[model samples]
Target chain A: MYPNDGFRELDRQECLRLLAKVPVGRIVHTRQALPAVLPVNFSLEEDGAVVLRTAAASELVRAVDGVVVAFEADEVDAATRSGWSVVVTGPAGVVTDPGEHERLVRTGPRSWVPWPQEVFVRIEPELVTGRALVGGRSLYGVRPPKWIPARR
Target chain B: MYPNDGFRELDRQECLRLLAKVPVGRIVHTRQALPAVLPVNFSLEEDGAVVLRTAAASELVRAVDGVVVAFEADEVDAATRSGWSVVVTGPAGVVTDPGEHERLVRTGPRSWVPWPQEVFVRIEPELVTGRALVGGRSLYGVRPPKWIPARR
Candidate 1:
């Protein structure tokens, strides 16, 4: 059972762990009527961000880039009474630059099995929040990235 | 490993089974520059349709009713080397009648965690497609509803 209190913030490590376990996630964006949510196969980048592929003409490709989008992944283990969810809200951009595209392509095997028309889009997270359900207790929290001082 | 030829078409029973196993699904719609997909917790109605709940102010609420929306749910079992997916494309509408709403609320417990602001939306499926990966083979196909004779 979740606590009656408000959702708690999650740490960076906890968020990353939750994101890694879920293979499919929901990408939320504003559409014509209300916000729309779609599921897609996703992978974690070296920097703990989310990456997914679609078609060049895919609606996903068009709405995500240069827009603020929310990506979420989660897993639930009923028998063990545990589950975790991680959400990344950030501005998304297309990776047209050869170097960045190559990096994403090589990070992992292509997981999406979409129709012939699909392209890839990646989300660079700005805010991350996660929650873990353990023994019927929910632990939730938000974590911001750490910043280091710039060297002169 | 799925067959080189791709996934196989699944039957109605298979589609329902696959749908029950997955917790998250994507609802795709066009509003922004491209199509938008969002993650949602859904329930299968008694009449063999999908049901979703959202707030009255939700953009989805405005766009879904009497609109063609695409709903997809899938599950992948890596260790077993098997997976299945089901896609429903059809017209959606709000269930405003009191009797229908009560029946849904009384149906088996809602799998989704409760949200304070919830409005129910129902999808009247027009076309259904499903695919399954089994024994290194991928099967795919579509199922349209049967036509009934008119009554005197």
Candidate 2:
């Protein structure tokens, strides 16, 4: 459980690890009266960012800009009684730059299921938060883990 | 593969099956210049509807009223060279009635992970749509299956 004072901040590498283990995640963005969330396939980037794919004219692509979007990924190990979740909140937009898109194609966004026709989308995170559940019989309480930022 | 006209509309039972097989899906809503797509967990109700969970104070509760929110679930069977997708688009909103909430609890959502403290949200679908992929050798195209309206 997070302290009421604030959500514990996670370092970049820890966030990356959490992102990698979770197969599915929620993307939250503003719509009319409130925010909306959708699920997408994603991969962790070398810079500790997130990348996913969508159709070229996807509504998700249009929502990018000053909007605050959140991408959350989590994994739970029931037998071990442990789990972790990472949320990357930042600016999102379509990767229109030809050079950047090509580079990403070469080195970023690995997919569990192959779908090469999908267009790639990138998230530049402004805030990264995460929590880990540990202890039980192997039992313990859930709490936010210590975070260290990735070295730039 | 579907014909150029559009993917076939799916039946209610088929939509339920597609929902059960996929672990992730997107909830799409329109905002400003673009539409917002967020990932969410959903399940097929006994009445052949879809149910989800979200924070009571979530924007989703507000945005879903009378608006067209698209809930999509899909999966690909690589070995069989087949895949199928179901999309439920309709009016969505928060469910606060104790009776309704309890009924949903008894039925359970299709979540791989457990979320004991989460709140339940339900979507009354107005339209159900779907498609399927078949064939082993060729990259078959997509086509619409069928469309069904919600029960009055």
Candidate 3:
């Protein structure tokens, strides 16, 4: 609802597009009753679910599974100070079905660590929100300067 | 404690240094009992508390005040797949003292939007943690390739 704030809200479609363009995002969850953030490279499933891998026994796995988490990804240009950011909030669940696990092994993001037997965690895109900040223009639409002709 | 994961844990000093190097980061908090993340341009105070400007009437101000929040910043090189990330978890508060507000207005980050009378929110750096992912080396200490001579 905010207008003329140098930022525009991105629709769900646009949010997903921006999210898919970036391989890394920060995950926000609770740790020890306090908020914690971790960066991970993630890949999106066909339905826009986020999938990432971590050690099967890692604390992150234990802390995030079946809990609500927020994931954010953004791309900004330092020179222009323009970019878009997307945040997805939803329940996080560890992939347990053997068939789904097998499919993920072949299609999901590979572990960045050398450790083996990584577990897959999927974050359902229940609440998706995004915003784009441009120095003076809209990310999806650009208008010519007033002095410039509309045609040509 | 977990080593050899292509990532290295960073100390508090290093985390602060990296955090100071970036102009923008994501702030994580709770909204309606669900996690939410928002990107904001922030400045660091002498004690490393994060100061960011937001609209005085913004929802973020209400949702985060008197609550623990998490802030994250990172620098990653897509080409080499190497980077460092830092997470700061602490209490968030709005600058209330007229003296502090006046001082912040002079030295803190200015509002990016064209809105007047912005508010300054400070997040204390309580539990600062960071990690660096340098493909084959540490961000703090770079080791020579095994084949390279020690003195070369």
Question: List-wise, what DockQ does each model earn?
Answer: 0.08, 0.09, 0.24
TM-score of chain A of each: 0.75, 0.72, 0.84
The superposed Cα distance between candidate 2 and the true structure at residue B67, in angstroms, equals 8.9
Tens-digit per-residue lDDT, A69-113, candidate 1:
877666655444355657777787767877877776677426434
> Any residue pairs clashing in model 3, and if so which?
none
For model 3, how does the per-residue alpha-carbon lDDT over B1-152 read when each residue is reduced to its tens digit?
Answer: 12344356799998999999988888888888888787778899888899988767677778788899998888876446678888888899999999999999899985554344577899999878887766555543544111000110
Q: Give the TM-score of candidate 2.
A: 0.55
Cα lDDT of model 2 by residue, A29-65, tens digit: 6544444454455767767567776545445665644
> Across residues B1-152, which tens digit of lDDT does each residue of candidate 1 receive?
01122446677777777777765566666544444454456787655578876554556666567787877776655444466657766777878888887787776225333444555778766666676655332233331110000111
lDDT of 3 at B55: 68
Which 10-residue window of candidate 1 chain A scores lowest in summed lDDT? A143-152
- How would the docking of model 1 be graded? incorrect
lDDT of 3 at B114: 31
Best to worst by TM-score, what's the order?
A: 3, 1, 2
Q: What is the per-residue lDDT of model 2 for residues B1-152, given as tens digits with 9 covering 90 to 100?
A: 11231234467778777677654455666544344454455677666466776544445555555565767666644345355666676677666688888877777563333333445656666666666545343443342111111111
**Which docking category, incorrect, acceptable, medium or high, applies to candidate 2?**
incorrect
**A1-152 in candidate 3: lDDT tens per residue?**
12334456799899998898887888888888888777778889878799987767777787789999998888865446677788888999999999999998899886554344667899999988877766544543553111000111
| Local error of candidate 2 at residue B25 (angstroms) | 7.3
- Number of the predicted model whose TM-score against the real structure is largest: 3
lDDT of each: 0.58, 0.55, 0.74
Relative to the real complex, the DockQ score for model 3 comes to 0.24
